[model samples]
Target: MSITTLERPAAENDGDGDDGTGSGVGTDAARATVAGGEAPAAPTRIPSKEGVEVGPRRRLRESTLDERFNILGALVAGPTVATLLFGWFTPLTGPIGWVVVAFLAFIGFYILLVSLRSDREEVKDRVLTVLLISAGTILFGALAFVVVYAVGRGSVALPHLNFFTQTMELAGPLDGLDVGGISHAIVGTLIQISIALAITIPLGITTAVFLNEIGGKFARFVRTISDAMTALPSIVAGLFVYAAIIQLITHQRSGFAASLAISVMMLPIIIRASDVVLRLVPGNLREASYALGSTRWRTVWSVVLPTARSGLVTAVILGTARGIGETSPVLLTSGITAVMNLNPFSGPMISLPLQVFDFVKSPEPNIIARGFGTAAVLILLVLLLFVIARLIGGKGPGQLSDRQRRRVAQQSVDDLQRIAARNHLLTPSPAPTTQESSP
Candidate 1:
């Protein structure tokens, strides 16, 4: 037999020097073809950029600090420049016009800077983000200003312990802030709100449940009416109670009458908000409860209400917030009196809002200070109510505190053990097998 040695073309192996071993399987195949006395086929080479391995690239992350600084610097610089330019060129006296101009300038400058580096989509996103943040900042700033102004103006009265403890009955409108207090107003406000909540919470929640669960033609009509009533003016609500109950039945203005008016104002808000919240309850929850042989009411109580409990509380709180600050209704229904009147049924009562209104209308600067003081007190009371509501509402559905979780686990264990015990009792023991061979 003749020995055959495979050799590759010199041109093919120019850059990649052959060290006896083939470059790859393709090189070995080409050599084999040549050794077989057939013309060697050209090897296929993979095309690639020198010293590069291509793959997907990762996106860059945001420079949060730098971006924040940029935004802040723009806001400051734009406002300052606009104010200076407006003062030099025009006779603009008010800060409001200057602020508007500055805001517009800031937005334009920010967008221009963003467009330099970012694409259209990114620029749009940044612009929207800045606008939203600016709006939020303005809103919070206004709120802070109000609170600060109230507290500062009221400090004249607030420092006196008697301002919280004593009544305004003995003190004249011109009396010093240290002499009189808003004790009656505080008491009246609480009593009226409590009564309103007592009346509205049940009726509103039931109405919402009716709208969502037993919806029909009547339900739709009720829903439409409630929706319309949400926009009803406070004075209109007071007038309604005045006509319906106060005039026809009571024949006098009282805290009870004021509660009726407040309830009227609050009912629609509660019903509408609760209805929305209840609708958000997952259908699967209701279906699961039914699958377990639960009735509609039982399912609502055990599963649905618990699931939406937090939201329901929020609805009630919103209603309270809306009604709490109402001056017109309280002024109309509950006649203002400086002296404390505890009786909600017979005598005239005055709430914080009414007290504030009465005080502010006075010509005395001291009385005006008392009005701000009352307003400050009202703000604090609202904040306290909010905190209380949050605490009472507790955890949302499917969320349990550590202690609650342990209790539930223990209860479950007890139930499982009871079930196992009952099954053992129901299941008969096998008959004792006889010793067949022993006999």
Candidate 2:
């Protein structure tokens, strides 16, 4: 049999040396068709550039000049019209009523303005954005009001340095702010919270780990119990401690009892929060560790814990905040004391919340000021705790601080050196290099 060689047509494929479609499959198929082989590929249609923009595309999210004008106009006109309706025509009285009407009118005007020049989607988007901004403003305003109101009212007491140093043990209800301090309450709070944290952290984290890593029917039962405990009232926790530990065992209210009650409130919160954080650890991390011959516990300790450290700290902060601010539990479990009680197990203890409660009960202005001052102190303490926790474990997964990055780089260098040393030990004489090392 004689062989036949396939060749390309001269005119059809000058630009691409194939089909002008810029595909080699077309050329291969043509040769195949000539030699009685595969079918030719379908020709591709090139896209038209008739109306396509070569300039930088406009960003959809950037606000137009019209939108800004509309917003400004609506803000001015809506409130103006609302003020007229309230003041000129309507019998509506009070700044609050006027403000509410003005806000409603503003929303209406905003939507009307946005709808005037934009599509239904853009109008909806603008309305949603305004609603969100309004919500954020309300939340921020409420927070600021609470903080300002507390600190402002307390400012009279806060300036006195002795307010943080002296205790109410020697001071009477009619005594001046200079006579009494919350030092005992502050110390007691520290002790109670430290104890509660000690008990809560290990048990909560272990329970959470059990729920996530070693789950079973028992874990589900535990989770359900934890969920129920989250809704448990502070009074109930105090009563539980009072009934079981005080009446049966200790026979008196003390900081330890208060701590136990706080732990009851904190445990569920920490467990539930920690469980969520631990669940977010990727499954592949476990698999990777196991593939490298790590035990389940070892993998969880090294891989899972490190990965979820930041979230775990957040969980702890939530629990701490919850437990620290609880008044009812501490009140019922820890009988209030004016004198500092360092021994958590022995005598009655008072915390900032309890001190505030006691101070407010008295009708004296000095006592009231002390109450507000104590509350402000509690807020500051919580804020300090939050700041510390954030500093320690604020970084999310795959995020490293400058210090951490440097540490990691150093560790990598150490690992490389160790690996090289091991290779040298295993095989005494070094093998010839494929290429000389760069200086």
Candidate 3:
């Protein structure tokens, strides 16, 4: 190969050296070629030294407007003006209306969350996501307050023993009417919820398993329809049950009708919840079971279900809670009677929620108070169901065995000892080393 020495260009010695490190030879060759009246070929790029930069890179700065005050001030002003104008045009209904409006206002405030503003932007998205959570708490607290206030006011009319044992005999004196109890409503609620469980549990779990585990295109379609069914109104469900059984068979309300209606309403919720929980189970568990020679159904029943049992229990509890409070469906499907009836297959039944509706609608103040008592009982029952669900999930303190606890304690002690030994070794200790102790 012919050798030729190329002279470096003036530009190569310039300040651009800081920008074009490691490419000095290429720059020199290009300069010599240009000097020889030939077009300079493309310069070869030398890999720059890693992590060393000679100069700061240029950056573009964007201009932004300050609209925090103006935007928020406008948001407040618009609502205020509208509320004033509308209140003038159509009178405000009172505290209830204001509370509802405040709730709606908080929804708007919630929408402002997840909104981005650049550094130069003056808008402050002041954690409106927290508003959604706070609004939910406020709504629930307000509800609780209203119930407590109503109960406190109504308790004066509620006779002491009458709240528990007697049936509503709407005859005789008003004092006699006060002699009735919620035993019938309590029995009805339990029977109805039980029947609903019997109808929903197996079918819902099977359907959920099929959809989540073995589902194909058709199963997916069925799941989609089931999800849609969850949103169906309770009254509509009652009407469907009425049309299916009452209109075709008896043309009358009964406990069976109520149970069927409640089951229909509950099925979608159970399936959806169970399906989601089952889907959440790690695939590895299922594979492990199968690898150990377990069949598909056995794998599901033993491994998959157990792994996701806690969530499934929660799903069942939630479904029970939803069905327990259903008034419209039970009202349409089961005739409400004050007397206690236990047979779900035969006879009219009365649930707590339906009784509350009937009792509250009655002209009698004592009946209204009884309605509040029923509501309180229903709330307590739902809360109890939650507690039971948590317990059944094996999260109870009693779930820990003595041996397991002892093991845990021993492990903790060992860890502490290890830590202490490590610290002693790290420190300049006068104590003999392990080698010295070995002798």
Candidate 4:
């Protein structure tokens, strides 16, 4: 072999090793010789430590006792505890034990149904929803039961017309007495609520309108003030009215004073209600009115107000209901009296709440029963007001008169079709052909 041939073989071996193109031991051996004198050794592997398996019974017992107790403890210590305590113990065993037990039983059953584990997500959600609804229903029922119990206990004297007309007439301890009617209290409640509505509605509606429709620095300020008013306590309202209108403005306990106090109590509610309703009015209605060249004020007055009129009325009615039963404010401004007084500007006023308060204080069982009867009547009156408000004010002309809505809908369809035709959006009916033309 020549020198060239020997160098050629060495270059080929080096190229194979450098390029890592050869799988033969020649390349591997060359590499090993160049890097060191010997090949590298493989890494040592260590064995893993083994664990002894527990019996199935022990494993299951551990899972059940540990996880189940953990979860159960969490639930018992959480909101569920409150529910059980309130639903079972507070209402059932104390003053109103029967009501509490029933409430708790309902809650427990509902919780059990909801707590059932399921594979279906929708089913689980639905179960939870049903449980919540059942709980709410139970809670409400319990509350109603308590109210009914109190009222029923108090309503023993309700059947007699005298209950409505009578006042406290308990004279001697032995010879239990007969009282007069609650006509005065009834009159006072009506008068105070009416005045409260009258004072609150306009002020509230205007304030709400300004806040919603006319947003500016001043409007924002007014809204902030109204929000503050919403949190004011009834007692505070009474005190304010007592200090300002009753003592400072005029030093006499009269229906007017009571009205002023109630008005104060009602103002925030009406403002908040009207604000919510006004805000709910569709922006499209406002824009449509503006498109017709209507002024902002006119558009708001005619279109927006009318559209939200039902809701606004409901708000006012709700506010009135809230103001009607308040005793503290009325007590501060209008001293309690048995005689009926309709005039708001003069004389002491007796309201149902005040009557109930008075009777509950009496030691006689009959008077206490009378208080319950009064409470029931008060609740009835509130319900009546709600119903009337719905009938008269909440139902729109369209809803109240189905025929009118049908007529309007029919007229709208005709108008739309005519417009569509005028716009060439639909093909006109084919021209009629004479019978002779059939030839």
Candidate 5:
């Protein structure tokens, strides 16, 4: 055997070994044979553990709840320990100040700990997440505190059934809680808000529609004015109505005047918000309506409005909430009255906000309690309005209730049957070709 033939069998045997050691030598021999020349160079393998190939170690996966708990515990415990140790040396004053210090310490410790295990990018992400969660918790905690405080303080007056049924007319500032109620204030609030809504809803919605649907120089001017009016102060609105309508036109401060002032505050909000909502309506819907030969008014009425109904309702509720809580305008326009005035045209009215303001100013504890109660009622009323709006607005455009769905299906079937009947009537019947058919 030649020298090459003697070595070829050894190379083949090495290639057939269970270990991957001789892979490069066998590959080189095969390439040499294919080239019909000297053998190619053998690649060298770096020494590894027990002569076996090894790779970089992968970080362990932490998929269990326990792993997560440990991480969170570390993040919390490290900062707490540091805060306590530091506080032992120094001193913290307010609870708020302590919280701020603890938060800062926690951020520093958390970033340091995370950086030890995680990459820079992951550390940044975790830190941001903690910050956002902390911010949200703080915000919600403050809101919850306010609500709890209001409810706790107001509970004293809320237990009396007479508070809902009677009026403050008979009750003196120092009277016991059982003797008087906020009925007059409630009634006045309802009436004033009702009048405001009646005036604002139509005008605001129309203005929004005009701004969105009609694009003229005048429309642009109106939009600009509306945008500017959104920031117009509540006191300014009250003053405007006081000067223009109350002083110049009506020469009286009545619930009507209050309603006008509220309308002034509410209109800009409703118009601006509704305009935003209406603009969000898809252009495809309008195009489809036009394809079906619908006029601009019909498209707006049937397609655009229906599609944006829920959003428009939200806009209205937001505006109402804004106007309802306003004190200055109601105070300026509606002179305070303890007796209920059901009529809006002639007499002064007291809304819950104004009533609360009035009550809290007195030195009497009972009156202050009543003010808190009225504030709680105002909050409840706002929540109630939101619920009512949700119910009335129902679902969005493509979403329908069971009854609505059934009605639409039935109407569709009826239309199809009617169209078939009309086509039957329009078609000419076969003439007298019976003899030719027989043949």
Candidate 6:
């Protein structure tokens, strides 16, 4: 007769050789012994161990309640302690000294508070964050001071309508702020910078394209030359134009000569900046263009330039800013002229910077006020230029305008219609059956 034994579940096995959380190996051995076959030699199994330990959960970016309390305490203590030390014990005087000491105390207190709870790495991270924030605040504060100072001193001259309309050609040195304006310098600056941009934009972008698209030993040489020239002194550019163009070609100081000098300074900046921008264009884009059998020049014009247009505009803006503020080059090449000279090729022109320099040279208080006003105007002009440049070329890659979107939609429709027509024409027609009576 055959026999079958019902073994107990491993949950009942206690202090047995199969020791890993009731795996039931003891029950299997018992069943095997009950069967009519010789029992198999006992197999060894390594007990499973849960050895992995999860570390404490913490967030790097988020601030804890304890951290917030620490910061608040430090802020209050830093200023209070610094004031007491300065007022009662130390010889420190002035707002600047108080602020300096307070900031130092703030840092020290913050470190101590943070160290109480956080480990070394966490303390270091919090300290670095405070330092970075303080540095940024100081930088912004200095910028604000400059802007506020300039605008405040110049505000006296900005109220009058005549300040925007009239020129210094008629007004004397001792005249009131309303009587004279930087109109001549404004017009002269516009013309000179327009000419300079005209010269620089084409040459700069072309040179940048050459460096990226058609690179060779000559391209490397050009890049090196551009790098060297980026740091070239403005005075040297002025002298170069002073000798080469003013002395030889124009034979006099003129707005045209000033523009040449400005272009010399601007060109290298544009090329180097543009090259960096172009290098950021993805290699995949160029390869795709090539895959479509596009010529190198065509691919650059359509694919690369459009993709990096905004960055190129930024490069141009940097060059423009650098060239516009240049006093020495404009002074050396254009010379000063009080009257409006629209013709750049023949006569002298005075830009905003040069005009400011001229105004400050006069010891009269009114003239000094005019100088400040001119500086304010320059700042406003620069801001306006930035706005216009951004408007012109601010679109990022793959972002299309409404017109472009409509055009793409129309193209897709046309392609679909054409594909449908081709499919219909290519369809096989059924063979005509022979007429065989009623068969």
Tens digit per residue, CA lDDT, model 4, 1-439: 5533222332344643432222244566667878878964422322224321111122322344433543454445444555566676565335355455544554464445445543467445644665687689889988899778866686566777766765544322233324455667787888888777778888889988889988899998888888898788888888988898878867888888888878887888888888988888778888999999999999988898888888888888878887888888877888877666777787787788988888788787766776788888888898888888877675652364676678888999999999987878566777998776554
* TM-score of model 1 vs. true structure: 0.82
All candidates: TM-score: 0.82, 0.82, 0.63, 0.65, 0.79, 0.80
Ranking by TM-score: 2, 1, 6, 5, 4, 3
Encode model 3's per-residue lDDT on 209-323: one tens digit a residue: 9997787999989898999999999999999998999889867778889999999989999999999998888898888988999999999888888777778888898789889
Model 6 misplacement above 4 A: 1-62, 401-407, 417-439
| Model 3 spans > 4 angstroms off | 1-125, 157-159, 170-173, 176-178, 250-252, 396-439
- Off-target runs (Cα >4 Å) in candidate 4 are 1-117, 120-124, 166-179, 396-400, 403-439
Q: Give lDDT tens digits, candidate 5, residues 1-439.
A: 4533223333234534312443446566776878998876544544354444322234456345543653576568756865785677666566667667767777777777778777899888878978898899999999888878887898999999998899888999878999999999898888988999999999999999999998799999999999999999999999988999888887878998999999999999999999999999999999999999999999999999999999999999999999889999988999998998898888787889999999999999999999999889988898899999899999987899999999999999999999999999999998875555553
- List all candidate RMSDs to the true structure: 12.1, 12.5, 15.4, 19.7, 12.6, 12.5
Candidate 2: global Cα-lDDT? Answer: 0.88
Candidate 5 ranges beyond 4 A from true positions: 1-71, 78-87, 419-439
User: How well does candidate 2 score on lDDT at residue 188?
Assistant: 95
Error of 6 at 15 (Å): 30
Quote the lDDT for 433 in model 5.
58
Q: Estimate the lDDT of model 5.
A: 0.84
Candidate ordering by lDDT (highest first): 2, 6, 1, 5, 3, 4
Give Cα-based local distance difference scores for all models: 0.86, 0.88, 0.73, 0.71, 0.84, 0.87
Stronger candidate by TM-score (2 vs 4)? 2
Q: Write the per-residue lDDT of candidate 1 for residues 202-230, one digit (tens) a residue.
A: 99999999998889999999999999999
Candidate 5 residue-wise lDDT at 130: 81
lDDT per residue (tens digit) for residues 1-439 in model 2 = 5411122232445544444333455567767888997776554333325421123335668888988988898889878987898789887788888778888888998898888888999899889998899999999999999999999999999999889999888989887777879999999999999999999999999999999998899999999999999999899998999999999999989999999999999999999999999999999999999999999999989999999999999999999999999999999999988898899999899999999999899888988999999999999999999999999886998999999899999999999999999988888676787987899
